[model samples]
Target: MDKSHQTKAFRRERVRVGVVGVGGFGRSHLGAVESLASAGRAHLVAVADPFREQHVELDSRLSAQGVAWHSTLEEMLEKETLDAITIATPVPLHFGMTRRAVEKGVFVYLEKPPVPLLSQLDEMIAWDEDFRVAVGFQLIYSEPIRFLKQAILDGKLGTVRSIRGGAAAPRRQSYYNRASWAGRMSINGEPVFDGPMTNALAHVLQNILFLGGGDAWSFARPTSLRGELYRCYPVESFDTSCVRGVLDTGVEFAFAGSHAVRDESPHTLEVVGTRGTLRLTGGTFSSDIPGLELPQHAGSDVPMLASVSRFMDYVCGQPETDIIRLEDTRGFVETTNGTLVSSRGIFPLDARFVESYQVEGDPGLDVLGLGDLITQTITTGRLFSENSAPWANRTPTVTREEIQSAVLEEWIFGAEENPKNATACL
Candidate 1:
């Protein structure tokens, strides 16, 4: 064959990939892999999900695509010599599944909120000898966020003073009811800490920590954290939280997240510096610095696709330098664990301040004036307790070491009981 034809043939040698878990967000991972497969960048070899039989349409869809299905990851690993696997399983299952894949000498694209605890993360870091694991903190791959990080390193945001971020995406009772483990701190004695900061809106926190890092590839570890956690929903975990802390780099940071709000607000991240400030909201960036020009190209409209493509690139021999390695997320896990420990426990929000409403036939609980509280917290870079919310109480700050050594079950099961007489306002 000619030189050009030889190059084309070589390019067609795609990385073989399998996806574990094909429900909810897992389906998104499957779709991204399929997209890359269609482009000759990857081969979607197989997928594993014990609950696959329950999803008939999805089963037929996969069948039609000539993709193999396994009831478990063990079966998939035993049957296929896959190049890599993307794990989109529950928070508790991440570490175990990643460990299995690593043992089999396979690369892993672990879905985010990497794990529910720091100890689990440390274990993964210890055994991932070849740097074969990549966590799916997709926003780190976004053009705007990438541009922002480089700008910080280049002294565009001179002497970065602080970073603040907040996100308010309201969830209804149906949301928590979707799965047996949803919103639970533990399921069947396993840590699943499915709260806003740790689960649904985790990208915001991850981005904040990533931006706070002194270097481009590093994430700033939290030295100390203080948090106020409250739940309007009757779940084991909090529905609303406000965390304030200091990064190891001495850059102060604050974040607020909630699933108990009436209207959805854009996820916002603001970085303040001595010279100027940069603000990112709803995937767009703005700044007070005159003549600051960001990259004209927009990031992928589908972040998961971008993340999967990048992982495939790494699997197909690209440099690992840009990948979100497991170690890059220590700060994120530390912040998450510390926030929970600092809160002592998730408080039950007073029913007097909580209103019940139907959003498209789903029962949703909204904290009265929560939108205002979220705005105030983000604007002032303060925790909800410091902002004087009637239901808010400040918990003592906790150190990273304390968080690492803490037992999650002690806090998960030891929370104050909900008031039986309290009823949501209609």
Candidate 2:
């Protein structure tokens, strides 16, 4: 992940990529990939999704090239020799699918939250310094987020004192009601935590790390976590929750999220500091606000566009940017794991303060733009403690595996199952 390494090109002739799970994000990813392929930048070969209906749309849209469709994801993986797969499955399936993809040595453009559990993250990422693998953290692809990062760096906001974020949106029970896996924590077990944190506003923690200097392991810590399941959703108690914490750097941040808000427009971010403040009232998708510019790309995506023009460039390899490294992912995942800790009660004070950081000047003048690559810059080295937490009066330690293995409360995948006390890991 050095400048000299960035100088090396992971170029190819044509990126013969495949698409998996063409439901929501998959279709969008396919659009971008297809556009790249049609311009001869990348090749869109095939797609896989459980829903058969997904096939008709892509088949109609992608032309006769190599657009094979499959009802099951495994079948697609087994049948096709693909360079990569754009995975947009539900949150629960993210880990399993991404692991399988990397296991097959297929580079993966996996949709975000990386995986629900940190342990699941360890299972998927390839550690070899030789092969090429990528995680699809599309939030980084948004163009305007880049602008915010740069603006902060350029001192547009002067000194970033604290950041407060909110994502309040109502998801009809229908949305969670339609799919068996919608609000559940495990594809097999009950729902854990709430619907929003893992489901809707997952990026809250993500963008926080990006803004507060990425890599939560070294730079992040939870001072206090107070949130409610909101007593609304049937699946789990918390459909909404908020927490306040200090980055290891002591930068205070407040995060509030809810899947029950029911608003025509949802999502907003405002960072206050010494000079001025910036706010993204409606996220990248646009809202009633009207004038807010948006980002087209985000931190995690900058590298993909930088040197990658075709599938071959990917196959031959391009850069060794560990922008999406397992460790970097662990930074966020460990923090996610800490969320479970908060639920259990006593949150810990990490070993040291997070190193203070600032973005590199202009994230982009445009409010809506692909965020700067500064997010990746934060992980240029180890950002958090990888060893057990031996620095506390009560040095209790938690790993990603613990979270993945913990028994989730009993619940249904898409529906509720009657039960008093149940423990299962979906």
lDDT of 2 by residue, 1-426 (tens): 332322333456677687887777666776677667777767677788767664675567655564787777688889887877777777667666766776676777666667765545655543423334455544543455556666656666667777666555555445556776665544565223335655577666566656666332122444433222222334433444444455655566666555433342345566666765676655442222234344543333542443233323445455534344444455466555555544442122221311111124211111010011111111111111111212212213333345455433322232244221111100
For 1-426, candidate 1 gives per-residue lDDT tens digits of: 011211221222598999999988898998998899999888888999998768899889879988899999999999997989999998878878999999988889999988888888898988886778889998887777787888889888889999999988989888888988888877766788888889888999999999998887778989888988887787877789889989999999999989988799988889898879988877678889877886555554667788888888777666543678888899988888888788777777888888888977888878878887887777778888787888888799898878888887677655435442223443
> C-alpha displacement of 114 in model 2, angstroms?
1.4
Task: List the RMSD of every prediction in angstroms.
Answer: 4.9, 12.5
- The lDDT for every candidate, in the order shown, is 0.83, 0.50
Strongest candidate by TM-score = 1
Give the residue spans of candidate 1 off by over 4 A.
Answer: 1-12, 294-300, 413-426
